[model samples]
Target: MTAGPDRPLVVLVHGAWHRPSTWDAARSALAALGYETRVVALPSAGRDPAPTASMYDDAAVIRKELDQVDGPAVVVAHSYAGIPTSEGLTGATNVAHLIYLAAYLLDDGESMYSRHGMDVPADTTGLFPLMGSPGEALYHDVPRDVAARAVEDLVDQSLLSFTGTVTRAAWHDIPSTYVVCDDDRTIPPALQETMAAHATATRRWPGGHSPFLADPQRFAALVDDIIRSR
Candidate 1:
């Protein structure tokens, strides 16, 4: 599959408690496929101060990276990053597509918390309050040993980040794809289906929330195909 110059650049944006390193496997695979892959680490998830971090802060990080890219890019936003990606891509000539990986997809002026109503299962609540520094939180889904290993790679995310609203709706202007993880324990599969309803295309994988780590090859292939198609 030959990719065109006008073809979308692949930018992977990770959600809260995750650093850009989360996409390392997928990045290497996509790079080998002849596509440029850039991972934007949001300030909210950085070692720096997260005092005023909000959804727009994350959006700004994405916008800054998008400006560095030469052409339209395919932004693959995972989890919380989707909220900002939805707002950041507005009027961005360089954004060719928006891909959500079991992530939040909010409409204009919508916040991530808006989608977390009664639809979410009660068990999902226990996953929060993850261990980390005062400002940063890590995931509690994996086993203790695995979680400990993974926690070292996590960044801090503020609660205010989730409450921030996305004033701009990038989805209305950009083509989108959603990859639903059937085995997702964080975000329910049913919720993922509802979120993907507005996407241009939908693909499913038999992995958990962190499919890029659980099934890197399949995840990379799907992203590569999306870039090639564009």
Candidate 2:
């Protein structure tokens, strides 16, 4: 689906411990569909002198990007980035739609940590060892083989990012879509189902947490359809 002369922009936001490169496949697909796409990289999960790109800080960056775009834009947030995107686009005028991909969708004034504390299974805590110092807690959960191949791609995230509270709920106003990965090991499939129940439309795929990397073509098509419908 294509928009008018003022085509809507598609802003892709990567979650914690991930860089914008995570969405490389989706970015190419979206670009082929004639939509302007931009993938914003957040602070890594482990940086020596970590930048001030907390989840909230990342939201500010997204807000700035939204401001520069004309017409409505679709903001897609994956995993941890969902919290910030939800808060960032609350009153954002340029955002017409919001998409959450195996991501947390918190209510106003809620933080990812608090939400995770409530929703995550108790048995999943031991999945990764805690590292870093105060104010910078980072965990690694990918399988050893996967991590070995992709660990270099992971970035350090600020503990402050997860602790930051979202002051507003963007989905309350914008049309929203949730893509649930049924085989997601990082985030329990049950949790994804619960979150998808709250979205306007839900699409399910058989894959792990990184569906954009595993199956970008289908994922991109789903996003394109949403844009066309709007």
Candidate 3:
């Protein structure tokens, strides 16, 4: 689906261990193309410090954003944010499309962690740290400084965020575009390809998990193309 008469607002949903600031680079590029940007502050990502924060909580916040926004929107969900966005955009009239940027696209009744075969019970919940060699695992292909800043900005995520199952699959109805980051060390490109089977279209990037950070302008251009496509 192509962009409608109204220039779609881009609601960026960041994944685990990140804040809305993760979209700064991509937002600037989208702004240059005259696209408005809205970043969702997911409650489950440890933003609110609320005790009940889970994927469901995050979806509630996102659905509220979709309800409050002025016009058609395109939600760009990265990594774990995909789960909430999928459920959050359910029945949301303002959303024109969903752009899953290396994000999990779960089917109804699927939890992001369970989809990956993690042996977590559905009701399990807690805080999980982003432990690993940050550079090699997440940003090997990204610039050093950007990777550094990302690590500094990272935060612990709610365990339930992954264990929580989506009740509705928004991508099943909303037009979607998936991008597989070939060099990604976190989420395998092969897994991304498997997820893309449900997308309206798919693209590839020879970058790591966070291409928007590696090359924001280029990533934005790709998103702009998706916005303009049929």
TM-score per candidate, chains pooled: 0.83, 0.80, 0.93
lDDT pick, better of 2 and 3: 3
Task: Tell me the tens digit of each residue's lDDT in model 3 across 1-230.
Answer: 23344578888998887889988988998899888888999887754445457888899899988887766889999999888999888888778889998989888888876788878865555576576787688778878888888888887787667678889889988999998898889989988899889899998988889988999889988988888893
Candidate 2 structure quality by residue, lDDT tens digits, 174-218: 889888877776678898887787788888767667766655677
Residue 66 lDDT, candidate 2, scale 0-100: 78
Pairs in clash, predicted candidate 3: none
Please report, in order, the local distance difference test score of every candidate based on alpha carbons: 0.74, 0.71, 0.84
Residue 41 C-alpha lDDT in model 2: 61
lDDT by residue for model 1 over 1-230, one digit each (tens)?
Answer: 12246445788999777888878878887777677778898877765536567678889889898888775678899988899988888989877888899889887766766667523233321122444341222333334555565667765666667676778778887889888878777778998999889788888877677767655666788887776675
Write down the TM-score for model 2. Answer: 0.80
The TM-score-based order of candidates, best leading, equals: 3, 1, 2
Global local distance difference test of model 1: 0.74
